[model samples]
Target: MEALLLRVVPGLSEEWQGATPDEIERIEQLAGRPLPPFYRWFLSRMGKSMGKLTYPGLDFSASRVLTCYAEKRITPEPRFLFIAYNSDETMPLHVFYDLEAPARADALVTWGDTWGNVLHEGFETLREMLAWGAVLSFRVGKMPQQCEGIITGEPVGFLSRFDSVMSRLGFTQPVPTGPYCRLYERPDAAMVCSSPSAATFKGGQAFTLGGVDEGALRRILGEIATEPSLEVEVDEWMPELG
Candidate 1:
């Protein structure tokens, strides 16, 4: 995990300040059980800070998670240990460990929102979730080197439709529906598409393309933006820079 973390976000070590033993103990007591080994290791090593690699919405920090539960802002569930919560409130996405399951080094984790919607179940471990977030942080945090674009037309199914089109373009959906966004990746580049939830009607679909050269980014954008299934105008941000 350490190797993968460093690989995804360079200079992360300098920013990582782990939690103290007392802090970890307090959290464990709150949980009424020991945290999964991998998560405990994470708290002991990087709970204080994860720099840019810390997932945007999920609250993996020991102190924050404890506060959320201790203060009763979000009531804890029976037989379900909450590892991360939607601190950003961009979406209700939260992750938890099933305490009733058999004990192991890592617990079975579920992805869901505060509204009791299980976005995904048991598809990722604590380590894998962190790793995926690292990759996304590394990609999305690339900044002005990337392109931001908006799709015109109806917003419903925009992100899912974008995912479908990108998948056909050789991109794979590594993880689906985290913080109201979906991530698609390929060898040379990665794209993140996000839309307001079906309940919200404020914003349209937007995406960011990074880890690719300007030329390739433009070409790929042209391909997807022109696809008949996604009938929308892509206002590429790459042009103003040139």
Candidate 2:
């Protein structure tokens, strides 16, 4: 999985650093639990890079995860250890590790933004979660709410330019949204556009773009390619339902 991500995502593995024995012991002491072997290996091999994804990665760092756990304990029962958060922290994913059975691999779980309902569960291990590719799928599925806009006036040659740009970036082909518009999606994000003047993009909650011209559209994609968390504010709007 690590090798695949490095090859396909580019720059994702540049900051990876193994955790020290002292760091590992500190986290186990902090959580009052023994870490699962695979998970412990991951921390020791790739903890730093986990949170540096184009989309938000798990808060795998010992200090940050411990801090979040502390914060959550004020109101709710901290039964689960938060492992990752969506780009804006609207959705946090967790794991129910058996503190008593420290070596056991457990399921990954999550709740909606309200934390009142379970959004997902049953991922049996960290490897299973990554292998399933649920992270990207979840991000894409939630994108419509994060950023959306309509292009009022069609701009000339927009579709072709959009296709050329996205295809060059190795994104899947655009899916038709309407006669004049199409939606292009990748594992990490999605975009909808019609002609030269308007488009909407959702990389994550903090990363969005909307109502831009062709020049701006190109620039925004370029910036996103470089830094997926790049944010530009535009008037908030939701996609019109059928």
Candidate 3:
């Protein structure tokens, strides 16, 4: 986890290589309200920066530029969040654009002057941005048609492995009724007996992994026929400049 923090912290592109306690308080003053607990915690852990971490197969990064220490600005994209992280976790500050109505509203809604230089035109307040980056993760969203045995396998690959034993006994995608029918990805398949959460909406088939009972297990497996994988492209935010 610390290693991961090191990777992403650098990508946040914060300006403050070294921050002072007074600087942090000044930001709070500029932002008007107090910082969120989670954000404060993140700051203590990592300073701020445009982060970069290369996993076994994935190379990801994030970066942000500081505009001013005050006022939000509207930009073309909302997810752009008008924020960036430095490559070093020293300072994470809001990205700048000519103040636009939409950008200002989004910056304020998601983080107000924090995204603006309203606090300090430095990365001192990056702790909040880094924290948000940590929690706001996502996966592909093609959705599952059926979740029979809730087996562990890639939905993007060959289907012959799907419930091979059940053969003739099969079912189609279950019609969603209540929240339980909704979708969420598995927490971790590398482990045994893990389950997905129902509260997570329309993400993947992991939510029902162990949700069914022994009897229900058989019933679910019966629904496992198979479907061809149609590759769906995803929009990944490749943070280049911080």
Candidate 4:
């Protein structure tokens, strides 16, 4: 998986890091069964760190605390390992591995729009998802290298609210880049929302802002900070994701 990601998307290796043996064992113990070979290989190679490919998008925990916050926050069955999720607020798409299936290198990947809505089954391998995620991250990182900022707030409704404000500003319709993210673009600026990970939920979700002039950025920040129910901090800097 590491070689594939590097080959497919260069410059990402800097953000990648391998997991230790102890970390792998801890995850397997949590699943109550050994993970698929491909998945274990992923953890061994790129589990601890994946740059933009993961961090608020396709977020797989380095801590490997396998828990799923579905319609209600309940413990998932041991056979179902909830590995990653988009925003818990908007269109909560989730990815998991079905341990009950015959063990294979690729594993049976499942996509759930909500808790029970299985939109796709056995549709993609863990490897494929990771590779695609890397591409998306690369594109996001390439956002206009002008003045950048981030809106940080509660994960529950932050992205939804941010999209609304951007839409009203005529930023154009949001394009779903991945299960966890949507990109909104305009002639002079662009914005993307990244779901909050377990590690950063308290600080809130990072809504990346770029490609706008100082005046435009100020206006955008005012709209977001004064919006109906959102309390967010507008930091005039891009988010740093490992």
TM-scores of all predicted structures: 0.55, 0.40, 0.28, 0.47
Index of the highest-TM-score prediction:
1
Please report, in order, the local distance difference test score of every candidate based on alpha carbons: 0.66, 0.44, 0.29, 0.58
The worst-scoring run of ten residues by lDDT in candidate 3 lies at: 185-194
Candidate 2 per-residue lDDT, tens place, 186-231, comes to 6545554322212342222222333223344445455434432233
Write down the worst ten-residue block by lDDT for model 1.
Answer: 195-204
Task: Tell me the tens digit of each residue's lDDT in model 3 across 69-125.
Answer: 233333333222333323333343333222221221222222223433333221112
RMSD of each: 7.1, 13.5, 15.1, 12.5
Candidate 2 wrongly placed segments (more than 4 Å):
51-54, 70-79, 85-122, 134-242
Angstrom error of the Cα, residue 37, model 1: value is 9.4
- Which number leads on lDDT? 1
Assess candidate 2 and give its lDDT.
0.44
lDDT of 2 at 98: 26
TM-score of 4: 0.47
Error of 2 at 232 (Å): 39
Candidate 3 CA-lDDT value: 0.29
